[model samples]
Target: MDAAAEPVRRSPPWRDLLAPGLATLVCLAILLALGTWQLQRKAWKEGVIRQVVERSRIDPPLAPPAAGTWDPAADEFKRVRITGRLLNDRETLVHGLAPGEAPGRALQGYYVLTPLVREDGPPILINRGFVPTELRNPRDRAAGEVAGPVTVTGILRASEERGLFVPAPDPQRGEWFNRDIPGIAAARGLTEVAPYLIEADATPNPGGWPRGGQLRVDLPNNHLQYAFTWYGIALCLVGVFSAYAWKRLREVA
Candidate 1:
């Protein structure tokens, strides 16, 4: 009998191999787990988006939340109405942009933040929107005006939690810095104010000097996109592992 024909004893793969294949499998499992986690996150974000849409469609702004009812955490992005007078002389022009004005282009301009003292409610800051670069000057800021009791309807916006890369206004150095609501309020001596600001809706302001009604309610929901990316990576990794195992088996054979 040929020596090859006789049952040539061969060591079993398990007995001969010193493989850490378990670690590779563990890594693949972890990636799959992460992919699943992202999918869950996507679901959570989608639900929030739907809730926001529903709340936004609410007609006629409801009466301002009662006193001691202003919860910063809860009140964020709440649709609300303010029936108050605009204290004209007390407007602050922070950095912003308005193209259809004196500044001419995308140059820095004023964001007219005027206090709307509600007749029987808390004062909510109204961000009327951008003016022009010419209006950014302190004197220009002083000269510009919004006047009298105006029924402004808007969505309550959270304070800007980010800063412009350009230098902040050095108030001590007598410079107009960034558009921080709290800082602006303190400088202007506003009282009994809500921590949120109002961006006016599309209600046309007749006799408009500083136009009232440009609230941007656009929100970007990219959790779904992110979830898809992670899932795709997991699938690709699975293909890689399968290919690797096939090659390894062939080599052993």
Candidate 2:
């Protein structure tokens, strides 16, 4: 046991020496299983995309099945038609939205949320889309009338929340924008408001702030991509393990 080769110390478990060939095979098997799982996920995501696409294509012949805390199974993706007058008097424009509709590089606007009183029941909140900041000041909308019996065709959508970065709005001071249906209905003095809101189809609005009807359905099915990355890492690990084992076998020989 010279100083250069002082028994080439290794721990008890490391020196025990499991079969490298077996370990390499196990690593390969694990990688393949993960890749297969990813393919399955891709199929599932594709099915979801198909369902949503088909739902949006149809006309609003059928009504949304009652109004409550939105059952995804019962009410989501289905088309509905509502004919009612827009209550411009009590409408609350949630601030901050602009597709750069007008001049001045700043895009400040409000989403047009008017309470549409259904003939039989309480008023339902209809988001008519976004309007410019100039139109949202109440003074402008208060003067303009969204009068008469108008028809609206759009998809049923749930109200959104302010995320960690975005805090809940203070409607009293008019300092925020999010489609909080409960908060919105309270702020606008709208009684019997529907729990859900409609993300409109490509329809035009008057004041031209929010550029309404921009209902985007963009969801990526990237399970395959993700799986590929993970499997690639597994492959690299297997390759490295194989090379190490080969060197060890040569030294043992």
Candidate 3:
């Protein structure tokens, strides 16, 4: 064949990449948006941690909120003092894990939640503390069942939201998974019950079977790591797309 008569070989049409290019652009936008959202979450989480730290630093326990004045958002984590007698007969045990004697170990237990009947006000629930599985029965820890007028100092907490996978509480069987305040009050036939609960301090109990002061304030802050992951993916996508486009253009040139 004569050189001048040879047919020209053209590259694939640019329109062939229209679908992939649009897809890449959409994915990049989504990844970038996700990264930005995570950064906003990081800032929000930092603010929450700061608020908790400040609240923890406040010395001298504040008085418990009165009925009709209770605000979970405002009072959560606030240390408060209450003078009342514990109604141990109506105590509830919620499944939990507490720090064990050995380092880095956790003890499977139940949080002993008892209602405290105030002399002049409605009764309030108190998380007396964690009791090991073996000491779940009140009879096992008889000495800790304090009677008469007594004072309790602890941090106030709001009712917990049920998880999707959590089983419904069996009040009849005395089995509880989450802290459902209203449900517990109803089960115990308690009237004029406070809306919040208290996590007791490390004060010594008679037998010390139910260990107090297990309330943890540490919240995981991993938004920064997630943000970085999303941002990194976006960068990689851009680099890969750019390289592909460059190679395609060279082929066409």
Candidate 4:
């Protein structure tokens, strides 16, 4: 007798795939949304970089905006010129890391923030620059602290926000992690201080101890790569579902 004819196989009904199909659609939508959001972020970051370059590289620094008139958003990164006398007595040193000549290397140090006493307005914080651990004391670099009036030209910057892991500042010990402007001002008994600080350019100080010109604008931008990654994952999911459905339909009875 001839072998019994094998039963023919057929695709499952649409109703059988409804639940899985819906789930796949939802996942794809989520992934696509993430990819789109990253693209938008990429555009915003580009605009920020352009603005920084334009505002920071202007020739012949612009006048420092009048106190109470300066807005952080509009004036940050602007190259400004200010005439003031350095109040070397009340300087604050905020901990930081300066970029080293070798790639991926950083020199751990402190930023010298001296209050500039301006005749026209309130005291403004001036970030003279990074000084190594050895020169954290004023006596080590005493000559750099000029006694007479001086002209400072540098980029304006907003006060830094402390991170979750940053250490709390100790005024008594003179230990600081982030540049907390209000906190620093209050600690030093300064009132009506400028909301923003100035990062001085590479002008040579008398002793060249607190090296200036440490304004670094290095915003990370990997949105394009992230977008591609999300889209690729979604594509793979589609391929996997297609293969699974094909195998199920071709099963022999």
Candidate 5:
């Protein structure tokens, strides 16, 4: 065959590449979109983390706003001080997991939610802190329950919604799966209770049973890593399609 005069090699037919080309384009679009979405999420998550730190770390905590006065979006995680008598007798234990002694281990336990009876406004629910499965009973940690007028300084939190997998609370057994504030108030025969809970700070109690400071400020932020992963996959996909198209065109030629 003459080098220049012989029949010139032609590219693959449009029909042959159309379906795969369209499929590849669709996949690339999805992958790129996912990666971009992750970057946006990264920015949003960073803002949330910053807000939590700023709000929760304010010194000389302010008093909580009255009913219908506070906006949860604006006031959540704000450091607040409330002085009242803790109704230890009506405390509710919500199931949870706390950091164990060893690293990367979790201890099965419950958060003690007790009502703080203020003199003027409605009583507020305070997440006193975590207690292991062994100290689930108030009697076991009786001395820790300080009586009389007491002041609590901690981060304000909104009511927690139950997860789909979470079971309904056993009122008879006084066991709760999640922090349903209204349910706890009703069960405790409390009226006009505050709509939020306060996660107490790391202040040591007398008996040192119900450990305080359970706010999970350090939220998992792996969106950037996820974005890179998606982009990497998209790049590999493009390289594979290019190789496949090149092979097909050469075969036809």
Candidate 6:
């Protein structure tokens, strides 16, 4: 047969690609959605970081929120000043780590969370700071215990959420694995306790037993990296689908 008269090769019908096209579109939509969501997350994380940095740098702390006006979301990381007497006898020891005197080493310690009864509002938990494991006994750090009414300035923090690996608190032994404000309040028989805890500043205690100022505001912002990863996957999927479609078309032609 003459080449001109021979049958003209044509690409596969559109119907043949209906299933794969729909699936590719669905996958592409999902990948793009994930990438967009990560971008939103990145913006949210940046805002959060900015708020923390700005709040931390401000001086002349504000007064604690009055009863019925406390909002954990708004109040967290806020520096507040409170004048109250510490209930040293009823202090709770939460397992923690403190910066050691030497660099590159951490000392195992417990956060000394003592109750401070504010003259204006209900009692609130104050993380007086980290005490060495050996100084767990209140008697050992008697000098650091302020006698008269004291003023504490620190950042307000919300109760921590327990993780799957977090160990349960031993109320009987006064051993706490997490900063569960409610649980600690109930364990210490505290009435009208604040919902949040105050992380005390770096004011030197008398004996320097409990080192304060351990609030770490290092939040990792990797949303941009995650967004790029998702977008990369989407590009790969497009390339693969395009190559497959081109090969099929050439074969049909």
C-alpha local distance difference test of each model = 0.65, 0.71, 0.89, 0.90, 0.91, 0.89
Point out where model 2 deviates above 4 Å.
1-37, 68-70, 95-109, 132-135, 138-145, 207-210
Q: How close is candidate 3 to the true structure, as a TM-score?
A: 0.91
Best by lDDT: 5
Cα deviation at 53, candidate 1, in Å, is 2.1
Candidate with better TM-score, 2 vs 4: 4
lDDT of each residue in 1-253, candidate 1, tens digit only: 5555666686765533334456556777887777777778877877777766666666866665664776655665667777778876677766565455455555456666778786576677788666666554435444335456667777776667545576666555434545566776777787667767877765654434455554555467676677677778767877776677777667778
lDDT, model 6, position 24: 93
- Model 3 Cα shift for residue 33 (angstroms): 1.2
Provide the global lDDT of candidate 1 against the true structure. 0.65
Per residue, candidate 4 scores C-alpha lDDT tens digits across 1-253 of: 9999999775556655678889999999999999999999999999998898899998889988887788988899999999989999999999999988899999989999999998888899999999988898999999998889999999999889999999888989989999899999999999999999999999999899799998886578899999999999999989988886666656632
Candidate 3 stretches with Cα past 4 Å from truth are 1-16
Candidate with top TM-score is: 5
* Tens digits of per-residue lDDT for model 3, 70-123: 887777888888999999999999998998789999999899999999878899
Show pairs that collide, candidate 2.
130-210, 131-209, 131-210, 132-209, 201-213
How many residue pairs collide in each prediction? 3, 5, 0, 0, 0, 0
Q: TM-score for each prediction?
A: 0.74, 0.75, 0.91, 0.91, 0.93, 0.85
Q: What's model 5's overall lDDT?
A: 0.91
Query: Which 10 consecutive residues of model 6 have the lowest summed lDDT?
Result: 8-17
lDDT of 3 at 50: 83
